[model samples]
Target: MTLSSNVIKQCALLSSLALFSLSSAMADDHTNKPVVEQLVDTLSTIAGPHPGIRKNHAKGIVVSGEFIPSPDAATVTNAVHFESPATPVTVRFSNTTGIPDIADNNPSSFPKGIAIRFHLQEDTYTDIVSISVSRFPVATPEDFLGLLNAVATSGPDAATPKPITQFLASHPAAKTFVETPKPAPVSFATQPFYGVNAFKFTNKDGEVRYGRYQIIPVNGQEYLTDEQRAAAGKDYLFEELPRRLQQSQVEFALGLQIADKDDALNDPTVVWPETRQIIKLGTISLDTVDDNGKQFAKQTMFNPLALTDGIEASDDPILLARPSAYAISFGRRISGQ
Candidate 1:
């Protein structure tokens, strides 16, 4: 680390310690934002520059498009595949060339989703899919933010800075994933995880709480082999999924694992263990029938923070950073602001 960076870390540590000491003595206030919320707030304070340009519609929706859910992108556990003639899925495979939300339609742009938008006028939740099964394995929002920035500026010769930054922020588990981005293909995917980053859940009783979601693949284990995507090339996932789905129905089920008050800092990349078997809530049906057709090939957006409750958000660091960054670029696209 640079001398300046080391000094910055020290100052941050002291400030956090002082704040925690003061806060601990105070009465526990449910009114205060949860730890996860605070993390999100912190990420906003340290936001970056992501200027997105306009783009064509995807499938029929104005939202960003899909990134092919290939093996390297498959979730690790709690994965299930389903089939239905009524709903066919189409995914767009693109290169996340620059940061999370560069020009949405940039040929090299890799960000899969725009910021989660709430029409407020409507009540609807969309698809259940992911590139990497586990949301960010990282812990801190700052680290995730750096990763996003790195992704925004990445290219073929780009260093492993994004993933490496994330590992540093979260430590332990993230380090392993970053060091060895073990590719577990959807063809061989079993339990594909979702970042389930974070969202608010309003129970039937009208209580507001937080939680994360996961997409578990139901089909037998089918992960991508190392030979699959040695490159994060364009349409990398696109070229493979068709052959797999053509032979069999490609699907995975959505499951929910609510976060308790004490369990809010949930990051998807780490294993959540069999004991926490997510409650099966829904199924993702991927058929050859894609309504999006050419449109699907045009757009892509896959932010884990985009969620609806029964499903909700958590105080996880990366989740906190995602919405704001996602929104800024998404707004840039629709409004051209």
Candidate 2:
């Protein structure tokens, strides 16, 4: 019998909650180091050590743009990005893993990263960091570390069930992430990105709503077929994006998928149903790139938890862990480690 999407989400949520509780207890007993440090360590183990660079999604192209907010944007939040006029923006599109030159078409580089910096008034800024996947592979930082560790330990010569297989056998969400089909996009401009972690948005009246962000391509979604993927170059996305921009600006609509009363806010592994209301917050137009913008993208750290007002992060451990992890990366990069 085929199970419904809601049933699948509920089952995933319950499993994730149980795993999160158990992982927290184990973490409290086992390690004294901060979860962010552990997360970085595990990522390094999987991706190999790369000093002075981001632990993952190290290779990227930077661009400049403008965020044109919708009139109804203030209805969801009083955040400056929504209430203010069109703001300048900086964006980066990246591949997965610490290997900076990893092939874009490699299966390992499935979920591309999209990091945006909304330049608000008075030198203040808000950031949105998302990936191509709608839901995260694991719900908690502990499980995320475990997943990385599992992959690091697994190989053709590994004994018994193999580390990754054993790990996935117990974690249905992680298994789903591994099994999910991630086709290569024709270009970064054609891909849709999603913020897996839910955040609370508060309007001027102080009414709060939980939602996840989605960047829908204004050009519509398009993916390369297996044959086309095989024919693509290693750095196709990086090369194609700039070439495409030379012709015209690339655009995407910034949208927020508001959660229902029963939605699992803390479990990012549980994707909210499509039936949920989505509000178009703004349009992001990537027009051009200059030396300064490229340098800013290289130097600046985009932290999802870097909120202004009227917006707050959820209690998800993965969400909580991001800022510290990003700090570690930023420090290493700036200090020339």
Candidate 3:
């Protein structure tokens, strides 16, 4: 079944509260860090041409100057299946901060990332899962909104720091990431994609257990330093994604970890540690590349709420916020009523 609009708003509100609460408690901890330095390092490492908003650029991909869907999938670990959900997907490639026509490769903005996803799945997992390229994910949902608004309003001087700084001062949750998030990887092939949500692993008998999904990348991650990225140009992430596709097959193995249901629910901030073991489930391989157009390349909306059967969402606030945010942005783009 499709997600309801009411649910989406609630998720955003709850995430806002959670992140705000986290930030309020850390004033002393992050007071020493410079917000500008943090933003510089934080935004520069995003991977792809689009950062926060999915602007409907699903035309396809371009590799080595050829257009296609990124052809390096066959060798991707656990990438055993290939099927399109066929749900209409809109991909927008742009930045979380900066005006509509601004170049995302600017060192001052966040790097690119894809939001590819399909509509609601039949008997799909109830638990939602959304992950950012960085470890802390984001400190608050309002921060996300700020990102969108920043990009929407960016102009000469590109001084996005003002609004964000004001927001951090007003919202405690925004303070949590004062140390700077690690940033999204420059190449999706190298970074591990996480299900990032706690789930219940059920048995045929209806037994249940807590779990997490891990998309293990075949390569190691590489990030852009603020200085290096500034000199690279606005389309750096876009250039990198296609560059890797031309070299070889790109693959990621999907794995799951069964953790304690109680602990899993209580601690959304901690990773359940790989020593607990992540069971391999499947793989996703994009066998071609296409730089044809922004519609084909960017705006592909991927929501953790858009799931298949056999998995589920936890009570985690962050996981729940994605479906709502994704739905709002997606619904606005599609059914433009």
Model 2 per-residue lDDT tens digits across residues 1-337: 1123323433443344333333342344577655666676777677777776777888888898899999878999999889878899888999988787899999998799999988877666788999999989999877887888788889778897999999999999999988887889999999999999999999999899999999999989999999999999999998898899999999999999999999999998999999999999999999886555444544666778768899998998789777666665555565555
Whole-structure CA lDDT of model 1:
0.40
Of the candidates numbered 1 and 2, which has the greater TM-score value? Answer: 2
Per-candidate TM-scores read 0.51, 0.90, 0.55
Off by over 4 Å in 3: 1-130, 134-173, 183-186, 203-207, 225-227, 261-275, 290-301, 335-337
Q: TM-score ranking from best to worst?
A: 2, 3, 1
Ranking by lDDT: 2, 3, 1
Q: For each candidate, what is the lDDT?
A: 0.40, 0.82, 0.43
Output the lDDT of residue 169, model 1: 57
Best candidate, TM-score: 2
Model 2: residue 83 alpha-carbon error in angstroms: 1.2
Error of 3 at 244 (Å): 2.6
Q: Report how far residue 113 has shifted in candidate 2, in Å.
A: 0.7
